[model samples]
Target: MFRFLPLPEGALCLIAATAFCAEYLLFYFHSTSHKGLEGYYHLILVLLIGLCVVSSVAGALLPTSFPVDLTNGIAITLQGLWFYQTAFSLYGPMMPDGCQLTGDQIACGSAASRVRGELLANFQLFSLVLGVLVAVVVSYGYAASRHGRS
Candidate 1:
């Protein structure tokens, strides 16, 4: 069944990254404003989108090397986690105990809570990386075995 899909691994990664990029762009445009941390998030989102575009081109041009696939996997996972962080931190109940959303910006009541939120974001990124790594490895292994190369 999987044989019907003929895209190379890198191309697959690029497709996923592109999807995330589109979603991020939509969110960025729809948001109230880009100021303070919101601006920072928008900047990061733009950077991530650029990375995805470059990676996608590399993947299409050099499908044999796995570096593009790995990079895209990491970037896409980070983008996903970052989106979650932004959603929760700015608009959801996950806002830290001392933080309040103030007209498209987050105002933390204390530095401690802000630090905690940052720590949690780090942990989320780490967890997403781990999960993406495992999935990539497993998928690569399966593909290789199916092709009878390893």
Candidate 2:
């Protein structure tokens, strides 16, 4: 009954990107205020939504291009990791002690903590890129072997 469980790579990427876009939009609208660096979070969400839109369109239009497919995967993964980082840094348990939520604004008592957060985000992005690369290579190899092409 579930015939499309293994959707084509492009379709899967398109769906994932669309989902992330919807989620980010919802978060943007639900927020009570954007003060100080809070606005930056909203900006990140907007930027990610734009990236997802591009990735979705590219995935749909250039499904056969390995580079396009790889980009889509990387973009989607990055968006997810960024969402996690934003959530934890802004409202979750990972929030540093130097940061406090005042009304709608998150004030960091130490600039170093904020800088550390940014560096952590960079690390998250790098790790996701490596993971996506490995997954893509393995999937491509599997597909090739299954099709008896290599």
Candidate 3:
């Protein structure tokens, strides 16, 4: 809707929230058929997408809130990071032991290995989030020291 390009101020956030909401629904429902490690990863992704949806809506309500904006950014960042982690772990060289790419599906030889893979996925997502938060905090401190409110 190009006609609605210049949406009234905070309306932009609501629009973004709507988009994120639609994405979350698509992924959440579609993920039911994903199966195994793939399903678990998709579930994590869907949850993060839901977070983005919530944050965007919050941003609409609190347009000037820095924390709301930061939450939205971090959620989006984590979602993107998780996608990359999935690509590398499930489809790239980092595939867990006892798992193999058979045709187009990841086939783990045992339930334990699949569980291991899922835990690894969770750890990777957590690590990415921790790294981003640390970076943000460090940068904020640097900026505060040099250019923040005197």
Candidate 4:
């Protein structure tokens, strides 16, 4: 990308996807610094970041596919929302009773409690996904109705 000149087609998309690569690596290596519930939540976030990477690449390859573009947007939205949820759970009162935020790390009373917290995080993720799906469908339907199109 010399002087950002004569960039190849989809170069911007690939560049955007590279940012997700960095995020994925950060979360993967973050296990050393983050523990227990915090690490688990970050792991889930990494999965979402991976999705974003895949969708962005797909968008680059299939530039005309509106669905792929929509998917990339949705994945990015989910990643951002998950970040907020992780912060709230790890740094706020939403944290499971057994876990405590100790000096920038989350420590659990026991392994069993940490597992329970992970399970709760799974539930939260599923709920967020379902809610977003519902919202998307409703928005699409409303737009279609108003425009008299499907």
For candidate 3, give the lDDT. 0.88
lDDT string, candidate 4, 2-28, tens digits: 575987766777889999889888877
Q: What's the CA RMSD of model 1 in angstroms?
A: 5.6
Candidate 2 vs candidate 3: the lDDT winner is 3
Please give the RMSD of candidate 2 to the true structure.
5.1
Q: For candidate 2, what is the lDDT?
A: 0.69
The model with the greatest TM-score is 3
The window of 10 residues in a row where model 1 has the poorest summed lDDT is: 32-41
Q: Which stretches of model 1 miss by more than 4 angstroms? A: 1-47, 60-63, 142-147
Ranking by lDDT: 3, 4, 2, 1
lDDT per residue (tens digit) for residues 54-107 in model 3: 999999999889999989898888888888888898889999888888987788
Q: How accurate locally is residue 19 in candidate 2, as Cα lDDT from 0 to 100? A: 80
Q: Could you tell me the lDDT of residue 148 within candidate 3?
A: 89
Clashing pairs in 1: 98-109
Task: Say what the RMSD of model 3 is.
Answer: 2.4
Which residue pairs in model 2 clash with each other? none
Q: After superposition, how far is residue 38 of candidate 4 from its true place, in Å?
A: 1.4
lDDT of 2 by residue, 1-150 (tens): 239486665676577667867876776775436644455665665666677778777877787887876776677677777777778767877665566777767887777866665565556556766887888789888988899543
Quote each prediction's TM-score.
0.58, 0.60, 0.91, 0.88
